[model samples]
Target: MGLGAGPPAVKRRSFTRASVAVAVAVGLVLAGACGGGGGDGDGDGDGDGSLSVGVLLPGGGASRFGQFDGPLIEKQLKRLCPDCPAPTIAATSDPAVQRQQLESMITRRVDVLVLAAVDPQLLRPSVEAAHRAGIPVVAYDRLAQGPISGYVTFDGTTVGRLQGEALLKAMGTKARGGQIVMMNGATTDPNAGWFKRGALSVLQGKVKIGKSYDTVGWRPENAFVNMTRAIAALGAGDIDGVLAANDSLAGAVVAALNAAEVRPLPPITGQDADLAGVRRIVRGDQYMTVYKPFEPAATAAAKMAVALGRGRTVGSIATGTVDSATTKNIPAVLLPSVPVTVGNIKGTLVKDGMYTIDQICTPALRSACAKAGLTR
Candidate 1:
């Protein structure tokens, strides 16, 4: 945070999300569906006054949830359903644990489920089980398969394009002859494919990829090991840039570069404007990160869940639609992302209150921050 700026404002009852929920409930009820509160708290069948929402998050590999997703989601849920019993959220970092958690939520019979699956396709059967039980599922973030009613996510293709463009810009004169190592996300998560395809579309023919590896679970450690291997295979100096899929991978890649004793690390790209990524940007450890404003994505998910819970149409909420493997015409809200570098750190993340200069530029990084003109 900034020197005098206090902790970020993250509160449970601070958001304004109930109008859409209430209105949807009222509308559906008038239209002959016994909408709003199924006694299970989905507000789907009858206005029973309680909602049990199980939020099955994917992992702890990234800090997005601990920092932003959890509180924002909780706050939105509570604001949307004030008098209803507080919504229940079962959060776990492990996929196997998440599977058990999913079964538990199924056993508990949560009214509505918002999940960001670790393995989207692997969770299909579990999602189908909830569907079998007539529970409405809102596929959050990862877009788990099966009979999902709604979806919310940032545009992966757009994110990849941003990464590619930034990598090229960072490479400067080396852009054409640049030999970048691709540290991509797992093949299991379909979004990884989406991101990779977008990056390849922009990067192909323009740059030569020396070596690439899919880091399972988007693990920083895995990326670190892979980066080490890449360095050994293709001399550290030959690699020009790194197309790290997200911030965590970029962290691993940078650490590997330091270990290899590469004087000035090549320009590396990442997604998720993680604090670590931001700090890396300020310190020039990493080149750029895709700053996806999670609030808008969270807001869209909140609206979709509330609407689906209330049995209302999503016409007002849907920004556009997307197609999944099994489901087509899936009503979705895709938010755009931006590229953040040292040049615009203050204007981008600082101005948006995502991070503060103080939180970023510690005594160790003060000089670098000044060099980047991040200090006022």
Candidate 2:
């Protein structure tokens, strides 16, 4: 899905006027001039309720950041603090560029930052810099290193478990010593390792992994290249299943398989119930996808950001605690994820108002929709 438009509260402006590719700040409304400065706490360490939230996502455009997380965060922030200034939103997939954006935000001195780091370890120094500036940082979606104040995300372990379980079920007879290819996400993302570990816990003893590759930058093009190489190395026929990290990767895998003219495609697992991924499941191209409801995750991040900005403890809002490489016992809200397939598409995505029947079932997919039991 594509992003509709920037939130009405957003004010467009150049972030440091830097021409870094992929680094875009939706609007950088300075907090100092608007009476919503960061670390605006009283002598007793309690804030006067003035908030200026800054949001930074890993990517933009058709990515989840633009399509769901950004808008939902803005809405929730507005609901919680009506008088607060609009957040300074930014997105970039380049690690160096993301670090530059975070440094710029610190210079601007936003009250609290909501961050989904492109590369958690690469962004650690910048996160530390923000902490030293007395600006509380709330890590959203992906966890970053250094003194992060709060975190909100779906459990990566559970997401992988669901994907692994679904892939095995789809493989059926092949699940007994089946040889599969592993298309894992970028190593820069901590969640990638988390997901891979969770999936390996369930898949290791049951299946034989023929070829495995880590797609650099989590880029679809890289996935395609890797998949093509795997097809050439394994001769396509030996590959019984595929464990794709997400929907985008799954699409690339499918395309590569089709390019190799592999008839009767093997089962493929995916995550992030993107519209296209859901339709792929209906068409019997992909096996399943893990749906991490964006609303609750965004809302939780907004709540944590607001509380941190107001100089309040997040202990009450956090359901649990997580320890990062640098920080110990960090407050967190790890939500659950649901596995989506053709059978559960209606009850999960459609029933939750994520998509309409018309959206998933296009005119070209009429017969496929009928076969999948999807009807308006």
The per-prediction tally of clashing pairs is 4, 1
Looking at candidate 2, the ten consecutive residues that score lowest on lDDT are: 1-10
Instruction: Tell me the whole-model lDDT of each prediction, alpha carbons only.
Output: 0.74, 0.79
lDDT (10s digit) by residue, model 2, range 1-376: 0010110011112212121111111111111011133442112222346578899999888887888899989987776677778898999889899899999999999989999988887888899999999999998978788899988876777778888898999999999899999999888787887788778888999999998888899999999999999999988788999999999999999999999999899999999888889889999899999987777777678777876876767775565777776777888776677788899888778877778999999998999998877887
Candidate 2 clashes between residue pairs 3 or more apart in a chain or in different chains: 38-111
CA RMSD of all predictions: 9.4, 10.6
Residue by residue across 1-376, what tens digits does model 1's lDDT show? 0100111111121122222233234223222222363322233333435667777776543478757776667766665655445555666656677778888888888878888887766678889898898778887777777888877776677778889999999999999977999999887777787788779889999999999898887888899999999999999789999999999899999999999999788999988889888888887889999887666566556656666666566544554566666666666655567788889888778877778889888899989989988786
Which prediction has the highest lDDT against the true structure? Answer: 2
